[model samples]
Target: MMIHKIFPSRKHALHSWNFVMFRFAMLSLLFMMIAAGCSQVERRDDQYSISQEPQRIVPVEMPPSSDIDIAPSESTLSPKKEPETEFGIRLTRADRYSVNSILEKVLEYGITHVQLGGELITTVDDLILNPEKKAFVEAISRRNQSMGIHTYIWSSELNLEGRTFHFNWTAPLVVARQSAYRSVLQAVPEIDGVVLNFENAFLKPWEAVIPAGLPPFSSRERIRFVIDMVRSVVVDEMGKRLLVYAGTGKEEYATWLTEILENYPEEKITVITHASLQGNEFLDVWHPHFRTVGLHRHLLECDLTASAFGGMRFFNCLTDDLYEIWSQSRLHDVKGMIGLVEGEDFSRLATPLQMNLFSLAKMVFQPDIPPDMIWNESIQRVFGLFPASNEGQSLQALLRNSFFWWRRAGMVKGIPLLSYRGDLPEHADLIQPLKLIDSDALHPGIRFLLDELENPRKQTLIDLAQETLETTTWFNRAIRELEHIASSLNPSDYEWLKQRFEQQRLLANVYYYIKQCYWGFRYWEKNKSEEEALILEAHLQRLQQIGEHLEQQINSTDEIFYAKRIRDFVADIRGHFPRVILGWRDRQWNYLSDIRIKQAGPESVELSWTSEQPSISRVFATTGFPIFEITKSAVETPTLEHRVILDGLKRGARYIFKVQCSTEDGKVTNSGEYLFQTMPAPLL
Candidate 1:
């Protein structure tokens, strides 16, 4: 008999709780939370006396108890079969009834590993406090192991004491890791190994973890040191494997990997990474890991969930981009893939995007088959459209255009700037920070476009507007073409796709308007005139209209395809109306941001600041007050970040400087004087 593990959903929670008595529920929950004892469970320990069973939603279609048996013993377990390319799926949800069905269906696609994903259990403390989860995982793990399937858990941190406790990095001793529970491995011993995410958005940097004085470890040293620590518990003592998820950002991941490989030549630990250089967006660039000596330790993953962009609640598709990763994988000596079915917040379990989920899984077994054929087969089965028919081809075009437009929608001038994950902005606050989160500056390319917008040195307004408009236009075109030919397709799928695509297609307008508004604001800000203000407000009003439409859809379907996030994104745009466009118009202005002194020397000082809008800025300084004498301009180039060098200064002298910034459309503002002191003369 096979066991089933399911994620609890909102719909099932109501009935599942009805069966549990209040007293028993509280007692059982306490037992699970204490399964990882506060002081007892340590490195390499697998002691489990926990029988804290929460009320699991029993599968409706599950076979009767009389027909099932316990897991197969080790002696009777099936032999492992090694395929050319091994595959795995990362699952966060386990619905009561259909999870068994979902598992049974995916296993047929040749997955050798089942990663009970990171989102299923987050921090070390989270797992420590939730033993029911570990119990559920262990139950599934035993059955998976009997059939030669490997199980792994991706954990964000190793702090066992909880989110409050920080590791004693001040002491470079192994004793510092004392009292820390290897919670996941200790709680669920049946798992093959554990994964550690060392960087990316979730990391607690040295600034946060370390008190004061101690600087954060370098990327290379941090990874190697942490790997050694984890290896002791996972690999050395427990005799299991260790996988270090070095994180997904392109430069950060490459930097860490480069440092680790260069310093430690024979690192035996496996690294799990993704091919999408940006968040959930796949491009044709070469994967950084493939550039290294040993590709076998690198496991390439692609997010089939599209969690960062949005859930498949909309017509979000990764079919082509995912296939591109498969094509790249064949070129490398890579380890098996681990497909993450859920990310951060969103999932694609029961959605229409399950076709993408199954198709990517089959890639391990049928690497030679094209993604198109698999997609077409899924379309035929679900929509009842024959692969050779005109409606089927039109559907294909719709999917392609849908993905392309979505890809462009999240970007501003080619950088992944705007993102939505379900009902929320992927990042916390989208409108307030003109700069990227945690980043002191925007991408240089985005700055370049800001330059063109403010200065109009290159790419006219018409050209700039065309960037997002083309994508919006073609996506709309594809949707219209499909609607005309899809009369023979299944009504339910048509309704589902219509809801998803209409919202997404509707958002393509928001994308267009976002760029158009940027253009409109720049045109207006150059003059701050009545003519320009009306044009700018009109653009803003267009955005407000779309936001209302999104609210209507969300209200009608109770967020059928999850337009709430996009709605919030449009609201963010409306919010900018007051803070950005209106504020700019109604203020006495100096448009500098992120202003700082780069280098202070006896002979010269290098200063830099980013203008709110692109501009050529000149710095005027004097040893005296009020009157400005000497002047040095930022480089002839105009950009958001501008710089000037105040040279010909005496040692130990104090200089007061002010800036005058000039936009290309002929507007200028004089800044208040700011002061900086030159370094004292060095002794001879």
Candidate 2:
């Protein structure tokens, strides 16, 4: 090679040609080698011929016309379905009320669930090993019953040592409390869960004064400790899921508590809220699994007091707050718990007053009534207590004075009954069936008040009271008529009418819609700044699209069937819309991912998504598809994942999906989708 190079360097023509030839030879060798490799691959491929086996096309056999039963061939007769009447009472342990008697009364009223009072479990020892109490609990359970243990350990009077007003957030004490509570629960197999009186224990400590010596724990820390305690009891000791109910007053505390519970399984923990404190903020925190308590005493006393005063001022009070809370809870599809403070005398005016109050409380926590109608009906019911007679002037004066004080307290309006502007015709209509009476029938002192109003000196009070009474009467009549119509119609017809009523009612109150939107905006603005506003705007646009599509479908339907269909649709829409909207918002906000839609069957469709954090799913129906089924499955992966499946979809239909997600930090996200269609019918 050296000699050859030297020859080339010498600029010999033969040497240059030889060098070129050598390069060409090497290139040819490379190409040949590559070609050989390619040939071997081709040969291997040729040897491995995948046989395209003849496909056995099995012809689908359509049933013969005689055998092809489009409709169920057995009979067109409908099943003899039993009418369902659900009734439950809030069973509490008051000094005057016997637990056994109350239990019997509950059976009489067909009440199913009871919230056992903390007083019932007077001491830790009582909670753990009281034989009589244990026997009672066993009896209750044996009768296919459920009991929510009032409390494990709570302070009525917070002191420095035992039963302190303030909680000790130190790890040792917290852990000890958890262990102690767990031991109690384990010892008593009948106790369902613990109801921690957070509000009574913390915010409104029973101690008359706060002690200066001890350092107070931050609210967040307290909430965390409580949550940790619950986890220790339920997850560690019980070896099964248990409920930790923080009976809270403030929405902020609920938010904090929920944040801590985000680490626990949704099925394992639940938040129980008093009816009167429900609001959008609270709803945002608890969502689907929030449990509401309808306490009878608050409903009658506080709510009635506010309504009698006519300012709707009571709206801020716990009693008045429950109406809206119940309505909103139902609207949000949250589970509701009704507590009837029964065995108290309703025959006494005070008795009725108490009864009404508690009834109102229970009503507010129900996942039933429309929200718009909630306050109006509640107010009307309260005002129904006034009498028609001019006698008992003193009583009337007392009532008016009480009403006046309520108004001054910012619990109600000072306007005369008729002068107040809050009554809705539809709400009034709904109330008629409950047989609500006018002030004359309701208030023993009303006659005297009426007389005083008609009297020359009492004209002012009379004029206002009369107007309010008249308006209430009219409202009551209208509601009665609606009820009559509801009763007379066929089941399908009644459903349709209900839907129509809801639609008209909601539409009529555009202000409420605007208010809700504004609230949503405010929430976003506070939490997400300008970015949230943009996201919300996008959501509104999506909602508009869905609304338009729904409108078109609704409008095109037949008029005769419209009322029933529309009513059912509206009810379903109300039930399902929030969930879908919230869910979609969550997805868009990066709270979760992997949204999947699965077709379970002809009658069912399931929408599922994944979140690394703990979350909840709520399903709603908008139209003909009236039912849904939710299921969760575990998937085996390097990192274990959960797959949630929703089934029971209607074929040839469109649906909307709403989802909401929250994290342990109290960060909430929502998402929604509209006009999702089920898969087409399978080809025969």
Candidate 3:
């Protein structure tokens, strides 16, 4: 069947006015599909599947411009100086600025374009459904255009409300999606283009769209079909640029993207990829996709919010890092970069009006300028210039080394504990597993932090402990160093800079204590030494102090909800404390957590644990060795909280065991290997 029905046929008839508009939109899409060379002809797969193989839409020609240019305002301020590269800023949380503040910063930083995300209008669905939001966004778009700055609407594909067009891409869903895209363009006709990042999605449609999966050629073509379907309205009909996110770091993705771009004219489809491989957690080296062939001609997305490193709400300055990103982008295709400025939703990150937003502008213009120099200039702009002294250098070092220190501390053994979403506070289920940082693994979907940490040749627990402590200790020390110089500076500048540095210090310590707390448990599991347990206790106590501090600060939220999320974050971490503390001396935990050796008798060894939620526990044990062999006993646990005793075990025998917990849905996580010894028989 073809796309005869967009929504299930309504028993009630559409209003006469809405019916006319719907008719017009369908007609426009039909015209675009035919013009864009989307073949409606049936394929051989029609006989095999319930639905027909959807005909692919591929753009063959550029159509005329749809939007009329608003005459530039006579008072529009030309940038005092614009950089050669066209720099853009994508505002996730746009409420941070008014129309003039946005334009003033745009002119100040020589920004050419602004990509507006959910902060203003929320989503493309809002534009189609909410008249009030559409009016507000439309007014803003016009205001931006009047100032001679381009504006692009951010669209998350298949992610609109009531339309999660995920893996299943039948003809009806595809056509409905295209119709929705057309409606957005038709409604907000003033915007330059749409920034769609489904390509950057965790489960990218190219790989997941088809269930049994299509061949390479078919997969690429299928994505092209979706692209061209949107382009038919956004580009071919409207003469607008389509900025697609090229986020997959795979060379194959690059190859697919290169082929896709080759099919379209230059500048028709702008491919933006993150400059950081690990999505701006810290220690962000240039992404491989950023250096790829066709992508060089596109833009690099640089995140200034520093979501994982405490965002802009806390001490957030990436002045030096921005220089590196700008340098890499300059070396690549030189289309410039986009900074993700401002707080989004209930995220922990906030884009304070200050915090060196202009440093990015400074670095790109003078790429060779020292990071310290760029930061010093930005600091001078905010507060009066530092006197000829070490005070300036100390301040510079503090900002420059902040990111470096945070990365070393936060990412222990080079693995990040990521939230399900992009470091949003509301999505704080963070005591989860670790993810492989920046590896372009052949396959997608949850790659393990455990798998990487378990590498035999990787850094030992002791080495990680040392490095994490050193980086964090120095960072905290640097925060303290600012006090000595506070007397030399004006009180307000001192307070402002100190607050930023203090936030960094607190976050660094948080990462440090959490890392030590977790790693200490794992380390103690190996030898179960008294000294290690004492150290672990100390780390946990510090975590408790930090959590208390965070609670106090969040209590003073000052009406900024972003500041309040620290409560959720710290609470979540605190929630994990007692569970991980299960093995410490004697603690009864009724939750799912790390496997612990509860009791060992002369003839029996006991293994105990809890789960993330209610779960069934299973234990596999091997005797007198670290490896589990074919003859190893497999014990099944009946409930979420469990203590399984392996009876009739030889006395003084060392048992190697792994406990895995399965949720009701059958999702399982096998925690660390534990060592246990049965009591010696009669002290022989």
Candidate 4:
């Protein structure tokens, strides 16, 4: 029966096979098309394509309201009501696709306000030339307004004709910028306000130093210009409500701010001031820029919320202290805080930014939220949970400890390091021994020349290296601990954890190289050893690789607030790397030795030390510690120390002491532990 059925020719069979193949291919094509359609459907939910028909731009002309309408509410700026906290974020770029995600985030965190970044527009050129940006601005404004989130345009000194107007108010560009701003306001009246980033130009690091034969720009003139702009645009034109970021300035500026507020009515203005908590003058000597009155004091004493202005809204700038800033702001009667985020990505934001925003929301609105719960949620979101184990817990602890130490290190020098651009002639004061060595720039936290330090024997360099070593150790330990936890995680989770910890590992690697670089350079300079030079060259190359890798990470992440700083750190490493130059001043290095306790008793003890090569007469001591034990903390000498006779000691108790010294050449010294046993008191 089979032979009879197969009597047809082979050609017939080939035709049948081709037909089947064609049908199968068609079916597969259809399935792929359907799958792609489904994928597009998902993206549609979160993205608004630019190709879609644009919204109608209806620019509003702000009309005068009746006195009753403008009248301040009885509550004024009080934050005790239903909307206790007004969370705002600064968006660096406004794109149509991001609108949905932003709105979703706004809904997620109850964000009440947003500051549209100035990067979108600078001069009249941007306004006239960039039509797409205009459309984008209008769309973003309308979208935000629809969601009941107020949006404001933010810009630093007006940029016009390629000239920046930050501190140079007298430039002709100021007048031109005023008209340009008006056009922008008319173009997007849906925007709630305009934040004038008016910081004193003279206060900026580059501007702070006056070059030879060039007089500094008149700060008074800059102030006058700011006042005029505020009066005209914010008060007279009434285009948008005024918001000002009066940065850390002197008492005169604060007084002037008070005077400026006297003229403007409340409810029409908000002042966002900088919070100096992390840079508290006592703890952070690195940040002399924040030496002025902090927001905590300004809010209370500046009379910003007084009845005269009908209680103006105040805000805190979380410059460094991420989560703690919210509580501090509320304590100071601040209505809300603006997360000073810098970066291009909001979706899947950087780990730090996500943590900061979540913490802010929890503190501001969800006070009952447990911190551990948040931590667990964050871990799950970033890296799916691994099975509970001792190693997992230990890894978590190590990661947390690493985070704390990293934050502490960054926070300690956040502001001062901010101002450290390249070692320009104007910034000679900041680079010690080469120029103005006695300047305040030589803070312990901001040792700019740490890696290139000339004196390897100097105790300051050793102490600095020790801190780097400790932090690096913590980072390394965290990376090792993560390995055990990784085994329990899925492939994706493991990869995510590795990527995150990669940052820490690289940081530790860089710090490790920093110490090596210092010692290598020191050896080369001391011995002119060809081997040491080669070592230094190799280390420098490796350091460069690590720095470039770190910079790439910084570039990839949308952690805007920290991106500049992280890059700056990389640049600093490069700058301090070994480079030969003529006339590089080698200041005499000073150190302390022969530290001896001349007298020891129950009631008092005499401590003495001599500077081998005197640089300064200062000496520092640590409080009583166990002999041969690591001192947890030490206090700087309140005044010069020749011989200190410490009084009121307890009898029959063992005490340990250590001494440190500073020099005019900006070098520091640390003497090892000096232990003494107090004799028992005589029978009274």
lDDT-based ranking: 1, 3, 4, 2
- Inter-residue clash pairs, candidate 3: 592-610, 592-611, 593-610, 593-611
In model 3, which regions exceed 4 Å deviation? 1-84, 94-100, 121-123, 159-179, 199-204, 207-217, 248-255, 277-296, 343-356, 366-372, 418-461, 545-554, 557-684
The residue-level lDDT of candidate 1 at 379 comes to: 66
Q: In candidate 4, what are the lDDT values of residues 1-684, reduced to their tens digit?
A: 001110111111122545544544443343234323333222121111110111122222211122111212121111212145567776643333344455567777777777766354332224323455555555666666676667677655433212223444343334444555555565556656677665522122223323355555555445545556654654457445666666653545555555455554554456666544323331122123222323222221111111111111101112123444443445446666665443323475424455556666666676535445555555555445541546545644554444434432221112222111111112212224333344354444334534334445334335544334444555566567777676666666466556655554454455445445545455555667555555555656666665455446554432222334334543554465555332232223344544456455557777765655553442333332221232222224333335666667676444556566665566665543333545556757
lDDT of 1 by residue, 275-317 (tens): 6624323322225445562443667776776766765556766
Residue 419 local lDDT, model 1? 50
lDDT of 2: 0.36
Q: Candidate 4 at 173: error in angstroms?
A: 7.2
Among these predictions, the greatest lDDT belongs to 1
Q: For residue 636, what is the lDDT in candidate 2?
A: 25
Candidate 3, position 355, lDDT:
47
What Cα-based lDDT does every candidate model obtain?
0.55, 0.36, 0.53, 0.45
Misplaced by over 4 Å in model 2 are: 1-90, 94-97, 108-110, 122-175, 202-218, 239-241, 246-248, 261-264, 277-325, 340-684
Q: Please give the ranking of all candidate structures by TM-score, highest first, separated by commas.
A: 1, 3, 4, 2
Better of 1 and 4 by lDDT: 1
Model 2 lDDT, residue 518, Cα:
31
TM-score of each: 0.64, 0.33, 0.61, 0.54
- Most accurate candidate by TM-score: 1
Q: After aligning candidate 2 to the native by TM-score, how far in Å is the CA of 346 from where it should be?
A: 8.6
